[model samples]
Each structure stands twice: as structure tokens, then as C-alpha cells.
Target: MSKQSEDLLPLWTLSTTETELPLSLTEPMTPSRLTELRAVLAALAESPIATLEAHPLSAPADTSKGISLGRMSPLAQELATLAAQSTRSVPKAAGNSGEVLYRMVVPAKVAAEVSGGVLEPMISKAVPGGVRSALVGTNGISAHASFVPATAGAAGGSAATVGVAAAGAGALTVAAPLVLLAVAAGASAHADHKRQLEIEKITALLEKLHEDRLDDERNRLDGCRSAIDKATAILLDKGKIGLSLGLDTAVHTIDTALASAQRRITDWRAALEKLPPDKVELRQLNDAIAGIESPGSEFYVHLELAELAIALKRRVIVLQAVEHAQQDDGNPFESFTNSINLDAQNLEKIVTGLRDVLLRLSTLQLDRSHGMRDFTFSSGAVDKLLNTSHRLRALGDRVEAGRSQSDVAIEMVQKVDGSIVVLPAMAAE
Candidate 1:
């Protein structure tokens, strides 16, 4: 690629995007809220289409929605034009389009994380095939947008009241590996506690068998009674006594093994019952396994003994069913064989529903707040979300701004009216 081509590759601005989720329909959005929303959208839009080009399936519906850009709202058009006119004329970035533009917009980071890059290609595919992006010279343009919260942070360094709220809209992070290690270690320790139980069961069964073996007093008395009855009945009944004695000996052998097994089970149960509540999940599992008689259940018992570590290990399994699906790689188009699919994904579906509900409640709150012309949030959640945006905006501005590929942001300034995020640009075909 030529130097010009490289420059054009980065998103160029035709106009800055301004989200128009009507004040009447939304909680009056603050500058910081708008900033945060825009930053998130930008983060979403930053991902390159080439990164997603290999996927055979289409992007999800919401992802497409996030990248959407069309005829601007009239007020938006006016504001964009005014913003362009106000910024003092300067050198056009690299090549010469000479056309001053609005702040191009894109989805914020939250939207990107929530939807992935599904929307990027969807919008591109929708664009007319013949309409190639032909900017004058090599300067290609990126037109993008975002949403915002209605609250601003305070100045007295009271981050809680005026700045970023703790809930909802902070940076995305995960627990440390050490924490996971601890969880696994704890699980393993618990599993060890279970092994001791199985041993105790075996020990008890052996004792029960031995104790039942030598019951001489009762057996002798019964035998004497049998002899008396035989004498009264005559010679034919004496043969029956001998048969009964033999039968009793054989029955006791079988009875001893059964009693021993039962005792072993009782000991095992008692040992496991001593475990803490956290280990309860495992204890119940063992009990369930013991109750079953199938070979599968038997296998479960032995394997669990060896793999007590499995219970301790926790992992995020993505595309888990893909392994089985790969068995028929001889046919790619088969629905059952596609392991990495975009469909009725359970996790994504849940998040989508959650975002929708939040949006709906936000809309209702906006209607009630009368464009934030009043302090009337029905719930603390709305207020908290709004506050979080402001803090993110202030912090994000410090970290972003004037720090594009070329510009080095030294001691960042909070110049923009709202929140911000510095990340890659989204590709709209």
C-alpha cells in the first residue's frame, strides 16, 4: 500500500456524529453521557471488516444496527454543519478533498464488547455495490456515531457525586488468574475430603462382615431345637436337619458380604455429611452417583476419584459443541457441523434482552425527567448510569484525545463536551 493508501485506510471524517435519542424520549443526556456513548460506539466501530471477513455467517442484528449510518436527522445535519463552520479552517488531513466534514461517528466500546463486530459487515453488505468510497486523492473517510448518559461529574474532586459512577459504565475487566487458581485449589481440597469418605465406607463394610461371621450362641441354640424336633419326627426328619444346617451356612456367607457392603455405604455417607456447605455441591453429586447402578454411574465414581481436580477447575468454554461438529468436516454446509455459528446464541440473546430493557426504562425516565429539565429519575439505576458516564468521560478524555496514530497526547486535556475513548476505527463499506 502507498503512503496515501495507508492514510486513507484510517477513518476520515466527513462530519462528527451526534446521537439523537430525543430528549423527550430519553433522560436528558449530559455532555459526559454523550461523550461516553460516543466513545463506546467508536470502540465498536473501530474493528476492521477484514478481521471479520472470514466468517461465513452474517453478523448479528444489533451489530448491524450499531454500524448503521444513513440520512441524518435534520437537527443533526444543522448542528454538524455549524460545528464544521465553527472549527477554524485548517489543512485538510493529508490528501485534498477540500470538503470540510462533520465529526464522523461510530458505536462505543460497550456496544462493541456487547455485539462483537457483527454490525460492521452487515452495514457494508447493505451499501450499494457500485458506490465505491472514492475520496478525492487517497484520503478515505470514516463516518461514525454513539449514545450518552445525562449526568456530569462534580468539580470538588467528589468523583462519586459528579464523576464516574461505580456501576454499569466503567471499564471492562475480569478477575485475575490468581483468583481462579484459588477457586480451583479450594475445589480440589474439597474433593480430597470426599476420597477419605469412600475409604471409611470400605473399612466399615469389612468390620460388619467379620462381626456377623461368628454368632455361635444363637446358632447353637437353634441347632439344638432342630435336633429335638427331628427326634420327635423319627429317622426321615433327621436327614432334613442336616440339609437345613448346610443351607444356613451358605446363606450366612452371602448375608455377610451384603451386610459388609451396606455398612461400608453408611460409613461413606457419614464422612461426606461432615463437609461444609460449599462442598455440599460435590457431596450431593457423589450421593447421586452412589444411588445409580448403571455402568455409566460406576464409571463416574472411579473417574471422579482420579479427577477430583475437575471440580476445582473452572473455565470459559467457547464453541464447546464445535468439537463434536468437526467430526463431519467432510461437509461444511451441514447445519449440525458448523461449530462456530452465529444463531440463537443463548448468552448473546440474554444480553440483548437486558440492553433492550435498560433502554426502555431509560426512555421512560427521559419522558418523565422532561429532557433532564427536572431531577425525577424513578430508580437509582438510571441516576447511577448517568453518573458513571460522566466519570468515564473525564477519565477517558485524559487518556485519549490528540493521540491518534500520529498525534502524541501529552498531558491530556478534557476539551470535548462529553466522554471519550481512543481506539481503532470501524469500517463501513
Candidate 2:
């Protein structure tokens, strides 16, 4: 796998280089073997050096009866492959070819379980309360600590700190106490440096992810604003033909609201640029980002209101046409009445849904400390559009009622001379 793929996978280097597999891994796939593996993993989860030392696998060193790589399960096969790769990569001393190296690739589910259950808790316990909060609280960013162990020679030569001869019983070779202390200090320093590098890597990844999300939100906002502008322009054109009713005032309100929202977004972008390189400042930034209006909510509401305005404007035009047609003699008014009634019904439904959206907006819990109010729609603009819808609906109702009453009073009649006359229904009767 590529380096990126390896980083995504949960991989561990085995503590020992053994060509023959341990019974825990080589044993037949059973519940017992699974239990044993889990136990071993739990023990090794904290250490950079993953070893079966002092465990049950330490005994039974006979390699002759061990299972071959082909006979193992898929999981074991992968582990064996990794082990072979490790053995080949590590440098070997002369005449010490018996030493082997191993690595293991754990399943994703098991990795997550171990990370959350074992690793995170261990980290939480190890760090100070303040540092822990800075690392994992409210920011929605998690720290995944990875450790790389110091390499050991292929021979049973001493590892980084100590060396043992392979031919003899493993006897302790103690260096001077001062020398041991110096080695311990150097290792500690190296561990700290490695940890710092890992932290930087994780931080960079999270920053890129956050930037991508922000870019998407900005694009959506721009699209919505463009839609609202187009709709407003169409409405203004329609108004020029003498059908306008309080349109300029409503449009002005919408423009003002949109401008305010745009300014707020610009301010947020600026804030992102000027963030100080301090822990507390970063945490505050995270909180502010979280408080941002849910992606596109601010502009989406305005876009909906703009659509409703255009639809209502069209209905008003229809009403004017109907009035002009009514001035002529004996024109059928049934279609006009039905059309007006339908418009009224549809307008009511649209207005109700818009009102519901406004209600939801009002209920959003924006943090005033973060200046989130500027990112929301203006109340004045929303109210004006809603009130206009109500007026249009009322106008439609009056037109429909007047036309129906007029129809009832007029009747078409054919007299003895065979000429048709339209007169009051009472006179015709």
C-alpha cells in the first residue's frame, strides 16, 4: 500500500522477528484464539514495542511444528507478508540469520474500538486537564497519537539500549549507570520530537478539511445571492408595467439584509486569516466556526422569499387582466373566477410554509458573542414579503367574490324576434 493508505490503516510492528508463527496466531480459527488475540492487543496497545513477552506465547519455542504462511487465515497471511517485508528491510549482522521481524495490519473496526476504548483514555489520563481540553474539547478535532519504535539489529544484538548474545542464555549486559541515564534521556528527547511532528501532521490535515468545507459554503452562499438578485430584477421589470404594489420598499429591505449578511461572511473570512498562533485563540476560532449559520441557511431563506414575491407578482398581473376582460359584454367569467380562487389557495400555502421557515430561523440558537446575528436574514425583509403575500391573497379573494356576484345578476335570453339579450336575471324571469 501507498504511504497514505498505510497511514489510514491500523498497522503495528511486531516486537520479535520469528519466522515461525506463535500458537495464538497459528491456532485454528476459534473463539479461544480470538479471545487470546484481543488480550495480546490490549497489552500491546500502549507500547511502541509490540511484544508477546511475559505472555503465554513466550513458551513453546519449537519452530518445527509451527504453521506455514500458506496454512494461515487471510489475516495471518497479511501479517506474515508484513513480517517478511520487515525482516528483509532490517539490516542483519554476520552469521545471525535466525532473527526475524514482523508487523501486523489490524481490521478497521478493531482499530477504532482499541483507539477509542484504550488509546484515547490513556492519552486523557496522561495529559494535564487543560491540555486535554485544548486537544479534544468542542473543536471537533481529535488527536490520534502514533509511535514509531527504535529499530533493532537483525541479530540478537542489543536493541537501542542493550545487546544480548544469541548463542548463550540471555544474560543481562549492564552499562554504567550514568551511561544508561544518558541513553534514557536521549530516547525521551527523540520520543518528544516524534510526537511534535505527528501533532503538526494531524493539525495540517484538519486545517485542510476545514478550509474545503468553508469553500463549499461560500460558493453556496454566492449562488443563492445570485438567484435572489435575478428574481428581484424580474420583479422590478414586472412592476414597471403598473402592477407594482409596495415592491420597491420590499426589494430595498431584501437588498439591505443581503448586504448585511455578505459583510458578516467577509468579516468571518478575515477573522480566519488573522488567527493568532495560540491555543486559546484557536479554540475560540473553532467555537466561532461552529456558530456559523448552517451551510446556506441564511441565503436559502431569502431565496425562497424572493420566489414567493415573483409568483405573487404574476398573480397580480392576472387580476388586472381579469378586470379588463370584465368591462366587455357577456364574456364568460367562470374561468377567471376559478383561476383567481386557485391563486388565492396556492398563495396561502406558500405564505404558510414561508412563515414556518421564518419561525425555524427565529428558534436557531446563535451565539451573540460570536456576532452570528449578522449572518442571519433581516426580520424587516422577511416580514415585508410575508405581509405582501397576505395582501395579494386578500385581493384575489375580493376579485373572485365580486365576479361571482356579478355573474348571478346577468342572464342571456332569446326573445320572439330571435335576437339574444343579456339582462338582470329578475327582469328575464
Candidate 3:
């Protein structure tokens, strides 16, 4: 099956994530203060206002495009409503996990805002007392800022050292673009290599399909040989003129079916040969091969019908001969016989059945030409095609075949009186 293309997340779509925040107090935490902190955190988390944002997965949305993830389309809102009904939430930690984890639903814009600096001020204002130093963690959407109490006053030189370190980080940030460019190039090359490997795999599968078809043809030939053997055995055991006629008819039918099947296979291969390897898409090639609906499977059906019809004709001839002799009729018994007995309802039933089977065979349209018969450059394309094809063609027995009509014919012949097996006038000398 073909590989499917990845669905990239829409940058305009609103996304929500839960955040865990740690809180530190300048003084021992009072219950009232904690309550105030929780309220401020929840408000800031849910608010679309310019609260600090950070997203783990994506770059910030380009407001220039006028795409707002927060605004849902009508269809999206309906889908969200349906999804919400079925959505289940995991139980969060019971005891104090030291960090405060709160759920938030914010626009993509707020999620992309970086965490550290903007959060400290927000926490200071939200809490009763100002936060001295804070370590803010966000679900990347909402601030999960942890407030830390300010330590005893640091020596004046410490500020200077910290500023120098910040400057060094700025220098590294300037070089990030160059590093990212090199990584992108590497990724592109790897993707190309992967695609090439998939193409090679498809080529191998086509070759295997051809080989398998040849093997199937050989198997069909073997089955024909078996049918011939069974006919020979029947001729020996019964030594009836009907058996000989049935055998001959079966052989002719087998040959005809094989010829028809071969012609189809030839046509299929010819179509493929016309397609230049470079121009042919892997999917097209697979479809062409699959499009071939060979009558190879009908070989047994035709052979069985031919044999049965002939055997039944023999019985009817003998029966008529008996009736003619008893009535002292002068007409040749051969003239009265038919491929199906006229006097009995069984022949009509058998003929009707054969007609139905033939009708089915005639209507047998196979869309075997599957687009997803092999993997291609897009790995998921084949799989997607395979699934669709399966759903579309999921009915009836694919192996076109018919039951053994010869058995029914033989059974009927056995019921006839053996004493009436006298040589017909034509076979007399």
C-alpha cells in the first residue's frame, strides 16, 4: 500500500494544553494567599490577553496572515461539541505534587509566547506579596510559573556577572539560523534517500507479481491434467459412449478457457510494455496489472459444464432408444436424445443453474487494478489505496470457479438401468 501524506497541523487552529506551575513564597504561605494565587493563575491561563506564552511543538502563528486559532469555524465548533461529549480526562495527582498543575485552553498565539521573563511580573502582581525570584514553567500555552522567594541581598558584582552571561546567550542565539539551515539540508537528503528505497521496493514487487502469475498459470495447467486423468479413469470404468464424449468435450473446453486466459494475460503485458519505465507512475503500473481479468479461473467451470452436458446427452439417448424399442418405433434413437433429458425436470434445473453461473461469470467485473498494489515514493499512499480498494471490492468469492457438474451428471447416469446399455444401432458395427 502507498504511504499517506502527513497532515500538518493548521497554524491558525486554536489549541489548548494543561500547565504545571510551581509557587515559592517570600514568606511562609498563608491559605488566603494561595487562594489568590490560584484565582490569578486560572484567569491568566484562560484569558486570551497578552499573558506569556510558550509552545513546545510549533513556531508562533503569523498574525500577519489574519489567521486566529482562537476563533472556531462553524463546522469546527460543531465537531468540537461532538468530541467534547466523548472526551475523557485522566485523573490528576491527588496529593500536593509540589507543583500546581492547572488545565488551560488558550489560543495558539498565547501558547507560543516564551515563558520566563513575562511570567515573573504577572506572578508578583497576582500574589499578595511580590515575588522576589521565580522559575516559571508553562504548558507552553499558559504560564505554570513557580514563584521563589528572594534570597538575602547579593553582592553588587553578581549583577554584572549575570549580565555578561546573558550577553553570551544572545551571541549563541544569533548563530541559531546558520545551524538550523545545515540541519534542514541534512533532513532533505535523508528524505530523498528514503523515497528512492521505496521506489526500489515497488520495482521488486512488480517483478514478484509477474512471477506469481506465471506460477498460477502453471498450477492451472496441473489442474487441467488432473481433470484429464479423471476422465480417463471414467472411460475405463464405465466404458460408455457418454464417458468418451464427455471426456472429449471437457478437453476442448479446457483448451478454450486456457487460450482465452492467455490472451488476456498477453494483452495485460502488452499494455505494460508500451509504458516507458521512466514515465510510468508506480500506481499506474500496478493498476494496469490488476485491471487484467483473466478467465483462467473459469477453466474448470467450462470444463465441468461441457462434460456434464455430454454425459446427460448420452443417458437421454439410451433412454429414448429403450422407449423406441418398446414402442417399435423406426426412428433413430439419436434423433430423440438431447444434451439434457426432455422427460425429467432435473435437466431444466441443471440448465438453469448453468445459466445462472454463466450469468455471474459474464457480470464478473473485477477492479483488480488496485492503485495501492505496491509502495511508492509516498509510503502511505499505497496503504490508503489498499484500504479503499478493500472496502469497495469486499463481496463475493474472488476466485471465479464453478462446482463439479460432472459429479451430478455421473450420479444421474448411474441411476439408469444397466441392462439397457445395449449398443445403439450406430455403434453396432
Best by lDDT: 2
Candidate 2 backbone clash number:
4
Ranked by TM-score, top first:
1, 3, 2
lDDT of each: 0.25, 0.28, 0.26
Minimum summed lDDT over a 10-residue window in model 1 is located at 49-58
Model 2: per-residue Cα lDDT over 1-429, one tens digit each: 101111111112232112221222211222223334434544444321122100011111222211122213222333233333334222221013332212122222222211111111112232211111112333332332222222232333443311212222221112111111111122222222222333344334434445554344333332333333233333222222232344344334434434444444444445544544332222343444443232223333333223324232332423333433234323312233344445445444443444333332333322222345647656764554454334323323312111111001111121122222211111000
Tens digits of per-residue lDDT for model 3, 1-429? 112112111001111221222222233233234335434444544322111111121222212211111113222232233222222210111112211111112122222121101111111232222111111223222222222111111112121211122122110011111111111111222222222333344334434455455444333433443334343223222222354444455445445543444454445446555655433443454455552222222333233323333233323323332333223223222222221134324333333443343333333332223356533335465554444344224312322233211100000000011110100011000
Question: For every candidate structure, what is the RMSD over all alpha carbons to the true structure, in angstroms?
Answer: 32.2, 35.8, 37.1
Q: Which stretches of candidate 3 lie over 4 Å from their true place?
A: 1-230, 234-245, 290-379, 382-429
lDDT tens digits by residue: candidate 1, 301-375: 322222221111100111122222234333311222132233324333332332332232222211122344455
Residue 35 error for model 3, in Å?
A: 94
**Total backbone clashes of candidate 1, pairs 3 or more residues apart or in separate chains:** 40
Model 1 per-residue lDDT at 397 = 26
Q: What TM-score would candidate 2 get against the native?
A: 0.17
| Poorly placed runs, candidate 2 (over 4 Å) | 1-13, 16-26, 44-429
